[model samples]
Target: MGGGGTAYLTGYEAAFINPANLAVPDKSTRFSIGIGTAAGFFAPVMSVGSASRQFQAYKNYLDAHQPEATAITASEKQLILDRNYPKGRSRSEHQHRMDLILGGIQWRQGDRAFSLTARTRFSTRTEVGRGWYDETFEDLDSSTSVRDMSLFQQSQFLHEFSFGYGQTFDFVSGLIPRVGKLYIGIAPKFILGGSYLDLQYDARYWFTDEMDQPLFTRSFSYRSTGNFSGATRHYTANGDPSAAVQRHFPSSFQQDFSDYTTPTGMGGGLDFGLVYVLTLGDDLSLAHSGNTQPIEKSLRLGFSVTDLGFVSYNENPRSLDHARDTTLTPFAAASGQKYEGSPGQYLSFFDEVPDLNPFQFNQVGRSDDSPERPFKAVLPTSFNAGMLLQVNRLKLAADLTLGLNDSAFNNTKLIAHFGMEFAPVKPVPIRLGAQVATDSPTLWSLGTGIVMKHWELSAGAQFLSPRGSPALNLSGAAVGGLTFHF
Candidate 1:
């Protein structure tokens, strides 16, 4: 919900957000399908985008083990809390979680109509630490050197396909005939698959002017003859004093900052309606009444500007390997620069290097590395209204919508929506709705339909705001999508 916006619903899912409202059909050839899943709780706000560099490397390991307390004594703070109490236990991740599944079909002919849909969505997240790194400095100070570090961790996967068509006309047939009905819809979209990943980070350094001594007098002699004391530690040039690290992971790892993502695209639109019928009879007074009638249902409003596509990606996947050189140099002379044990001197860099066998990324010169690219970009628009009422066996229908990217008022946008259907208790058909917006969270929907004659069953629900906060007081906004019909 941080972009590519939308909101203005006609009826359950509103044809994936408006495909000429799928030729406004209550029957004829209407087969809709929908499945929904949602999980929310995202709080990562540091700003400057790119997930604020993984929250500045997770707040620099929580400011080096959560310090900031006073008046010692609880066994001197329980031995400084057992050397940092298991790294001050940390866990509460959910930056962005969402799931979706959709299906559709509609076909009508006399004036012309057609629709088709097949949608699939699966997004991944979980990015915290790792973004290129190679640092070493006893005190090259920039808040304790080791800056300009970049490790690797990010994720993404998507799939899509959609299409629609509609047509209608009646500009007073032949001579002096009634004038009404004029619809026009056109939809086309196709989005392919996905995959993109890049990761690697190495570390190590001894700054205090290339330390010979002074890391708290070599790890805990409590000797503070400083250049920033002697007991400080920071390294990642492939750290391995005796490796073993991994606190927790899995939140889709920050989705690797996008460059492309629009699954597919297409567009076209138009719709208009009018209905009138009424009668009343029974003689009475004055000049004597014989018959009187009045009834009118009108609808003339709709819009569309869909997909409008483009998606392509590749963001510098790092690389640097000099035949895995080993550092060596203890001392040397003659400007060849060296002073302590020399065999190489230390240097390494890798941003997503593994698979020693199965190398991938070809096509610069073309030997077949892997082609077929596009990442993300989208703009789906919609606006609608409908009405019909006949009181023979009892029938009343209603529909209304708004969605120009959910609206902030592009000519009055409250993404207002409504639905109501009733057909006298029997075989079944009872619907209800109320969707209003502005700050968001004001949904109340209910639906049910059964017609076991040919084969029909429908179900729907919309009642959000589970906790509220589509990023600050959308006032109870959660429940999203659920549908079925045949």
Candidate 2:
């Protein structure tokens, strides 16, 4: 289904492809939103905090200093000594989820045009365990023991907006005879970003009920962790002894986000394009030319680049929490006691022992998992290119897109798309397309659309590929959207 409308040839579905191509903005004002789900091919990785180890370390320090006593309730003790401390959350995304909601208005007044577009996107994820537990406690029910185990999961959303303008001029007499018009355009964009990730998990253990009926306990938990890493020295709780805590974290997570305009200040970029018409007949405007019929329409070619410039972020170093010390209290094993009083007492507690390094992965307890690290934020970039054939009412189109990581770390991905449109009736049409990529499975799609006097509507379905790995594969997607012209 090739050869049809001007929009098909330029592939500017939202006027985002090339602002200049929007010169003759469609009369219909439209809005479009797309939703898709993908499987994360990778297994979910877990992070945890060691409450037991932390308690043991605290106990050792207390024994050495022997501070004033303060009795506490069972609930208080559980809150202070529980081994499972909340350690924020983690997310596992399967693949690219094109979850975007959009609305826009295009204004076409003769050869000049302008458009405004805005969109918001939402995404989700989850993780299941390998099914195993090593930590065990005495069971009360029937003289049996139980281990702690669980399943973990999370979800995110973002918003973006852009405004553009385009102009066109018939210039065949100025340049080549076959060429028709030159187009120029530009757009400014503003993006608002924020997300909420809820990490939920279930831990199964044992606790005796009042009836002494050996009861099993199930705990549903959540954590709220933020990005911070640094070092500090201060008196522990009471004024007993001075202690230092060190926080270890990656740089990516600590970036400051106070300022949020265009990442590179207030600067913007421009987009340019050209549409040429080739005629097969003799020239009508030429020296000693006889009467001739000029060609009205022919083949058309188009090209454009969006966001070709860059936005630089603010340069500010982040503050970090200090890593903690495992042994401030010296142990006197021969005497089965320890001194937490001061450096003098610590020296006395351990008469002779090997010196240790302060900066270590310090294992607080017997558990194998490392302490949960601070979370990180990531931003992305994308590039697009496409072509279209216009022959009366039939329009065929194809496009290529690449997404690149422009953040602290980088990964490259490419996507290919092909589609055709057929318009049997003046305002209604049917469309079909397929997406191909090396990193992703092939996706086949079918769609239909309508262009009314002032509004445009479209609906589509896509069947994703990579036939196997059902748990981590993208099955299919249902997409629909609307656009408006002012």
Candidate 3:
């Protein structure tokens, strides 16, 4: 429900969101098992109106110039640079995430609960600097220096097996005032790293003369690790870029499935949560007596910290570094060779430069003999706080999530979520939610579900739009799930 389940979710669903809710005494179902999946993609920087327009203009330019044209004209390059890379904006990022809850089970007895879940999460993020894009599209002008231009790409897939436990403590009426019950929970997970990849490229260039016969000094470094180690070897030894692409992005379905199922490392993580349910009306007497009976609560507050750990990959890892300060003439196609205008082709200019050879190095430990040393990647850690309010058959929830770090799966931004659930009838529930974050598009979501005595089914879709855009874009998510409760 629009990422606002931190306080209201219970049973199996709470295992990953906020385990404290598992021990809530008023839960209607004591046991539950479920399976679910979710996926989403977003480009935070591209949500601006100007950026969207520029992207469309760039696409139109590409379509207008087709098979006959191998390189963009100077004017065309200048147009793209002016439209896409405005002043004060130097970087853009795109991120994608997918999650699969293979299976989950939760059981509650009295004021205690236990849960077990198996899940897999995949995330990828790419960040490209303005200078990098300008260089790729052949827009670098004379008498200009591009420093700290970089392209960073990273991805990770992890399989998690978690064991959770939660318990409720009834506080004395006068000791804690209006607080009736306090819930605390923890989930420890054994993480199996399926695959991991981190690649970083940094380039610096100084151009002194005109475009066709310019003299430039350039330096660049490329570093990568994980499953791409073999592919990197192929590219460096045979100069075959397709091998590197094919290793991560298989053309065949069978190869893709095989790659998904492979394991590369192992690690551990933990989630901790706490919730306080306010006592209202006659519930004060029950709290003083430490009764286990269900108390109707009007308000609940929750907090949680998740994904507090790291995974170390021992898979073949490689790092390369190079620096050069020599003047080189502008790139020219060989006799009968066409400039494909591809990213690989543009980057290949560095290879033709004189005295610019890259050498491999160890990234972690300083042992020169062990180039395959293990490298560690941390999970996306975040702190979440939420509030849930209940009145009759309607529920209102609000959540705030603050990412602790900017990893592949997380960003250092504050995301706010608001959601509502109403049950007009006993067996049907309707949900609506919205999310807002700084420098990102807003998202609106709608969901509905069928809730029977023993089973439930749910589905939801999210819509995204820029702050000033007239219509929503097709850049959101769809999620569905099935669960059994007893």
Candidate 4:
């Protein structure tokens, strides 16, 4: 519910969300074993409609049916001239992330817990720049005045090996317990970098002409880092950046992680969090709470910092930068494989630069330009503050998560989540929640869980316009998991 598990979570979930929860003591079992997964996509759309309608738009993109030149309008050209999100909205987002965890076992005793988990994470973001619009609707512009544009995109896929430990404190000799109890926990993880790519490009032109390519000058800077374990020579030794991408890229999660043997990249990070639970009743003693279920806390406050490390890739990575004014043939395959659009359509950049052109360098193992050296890529660090109020069999929670850096790839949103969990019956519980960001709002959520003795199953989803709200903010994603307490 609203991603709020900072106070008293158990098992492997606490290792990532808030490790402090692992130390809160569990009434379920001393040892737990389970496996779970969560996947979702978010896009700030121009219109708010049903899921089927939004998916239709995506399907149209996959089909690649460009509009005829005569069908273009003046208003559409102006929209393309502006650079920004899906439809030039200054602060918007379109991202897809998935996490699959093969959870093992966790043991808890007294106020300590130890756990082990393996997770494969995949996430990527694309900014709908003006150049992107030009790619899809280049035929609309029948000009020769030389319009300049740029595009940037980056994505990462990795596996994490995490070991966690957590502890709780009632009262210390030096630090008296103003609150009922204090819990602290940490999870140190070893990250294995599977593959990553960052591409940026700039084009100076007006329209598409094929023979001269609409009279344009272009430059591209690309990096294919951290995927050399089972390398293949996709492109020739001539070092043509366009030739390198002649193959189609199928977007899907690769289930086989056995190729992660050779450590092309190595990084270590830890999650640190602490929660203070405040008692409201006279019998809410920290010492006696060990025997009680859920610690009998009325209010809990927590703060956590996560993903605090970077990965250094020393594997053979290909870094290619090329620029030319001469027209080059578009890539094509006999097996019905072709680029979605023009050569520049798939290119995207992270920031605005004056020019992205660089001299081409051969992708040799010993080449100084594309040498086999370690390059550090920072993690998406985040800070979270949350409060949970428990009364009887109901819990009310509010959470605020802030991006440590403005451009951090994940959890970098200034959003607020409000949720409530009610257990009418001891074996079943229901949850409802809502979340909103400054750039977009009206994201509501709903879910439920069933606890049958030693087994637990839950599923949930967050929506942008599930109710067909005229003003849609974000779209796509469903989250669910299954776990056993024995």
Please report the candidate that would top lDDT against the real structure. 3
Q: Number of clashing residue pairs in every model?
A: 68, 41, 0, 7
TM-score, predicted candidate 3 vs. hidden true structure: 0.76
Where model 2 places Cα greater than 4 Å from the true spot, the runs are: 1-13, 25-93, 122-157, 169-173, 196-300, 307-379, 406-411, 468-486
Pick the winner on TM-score between candidates 1 and 3.
Answer: 3
How well is each residue in 1-486 modelled by candidate 3, as lDDT tens digits? Answer: 676778888757577888888787654667888887555544433332354563443232222112223334556444434543555455555565667888898887767899999988877666555654354323345454443244565667789999989887544324675646688989999998865666554444444344454444444434335445665566566664554445444443234344534777788998889988785655542353324455554688999998999887775666554344445534422211122222232223224332332322223223345546676778888999999887656789999999897776878889999999898996788999988886455778888888786788777766666544576654445555778878
Tell me which of candidates 1 and 2 scores higher on lDDT: 2
For each candidate in turn, give its C-alpha RMSD to the true structure in angstroms: 21.5, 18.4, 7.1, 8.0
lDDT of 4 by residue, 1-486 (tens): 765566635657778878887766544467777786565544422333566766554443322122221122445443323312334232234454556786656778766787898887766554333443344333344533333344445556777888888777545412745546778889999998766655555554454454445444566655545432112233333333333332323222333334333356778888888887776665345555344254444788888888888887767666555644434323211111111221122421111121322322232232345433457777778888898887767888998888774321554568787889899997687888877775454577777778675777777766664222355434545444677675
Runs with alpha carbons beyond 4 Å of true place in candidate 3 = 40-87, 134-148, 170-174, 202-226, 253-255, 279-297, 320-369
TM-score of each: 0.24, 0.46, 0.76, 0.71
lDDT of 1 by residue, 253-284 (tens): 34321222332222222222222211112211
Report the error of model 4 at residue 426, Å: 3.4
User: What's the distance in Å from true for residue 438, model 3?
Assistant: 2.2
Each model's lDDT comes to 0.31, 0.37, 0.62, 0.56
User: Which order, best to worst by TM-score?
Assistant: 3, 4, 2, 1
Clash tally for model 3: 0
Q: On TM-score, who's better, 2 or 3? A: 3
Report the Cα lDDT for residue 485, model 1: 43
Task: Indicate the residue-level lDDT of 484 in model 1.
Answer: 46
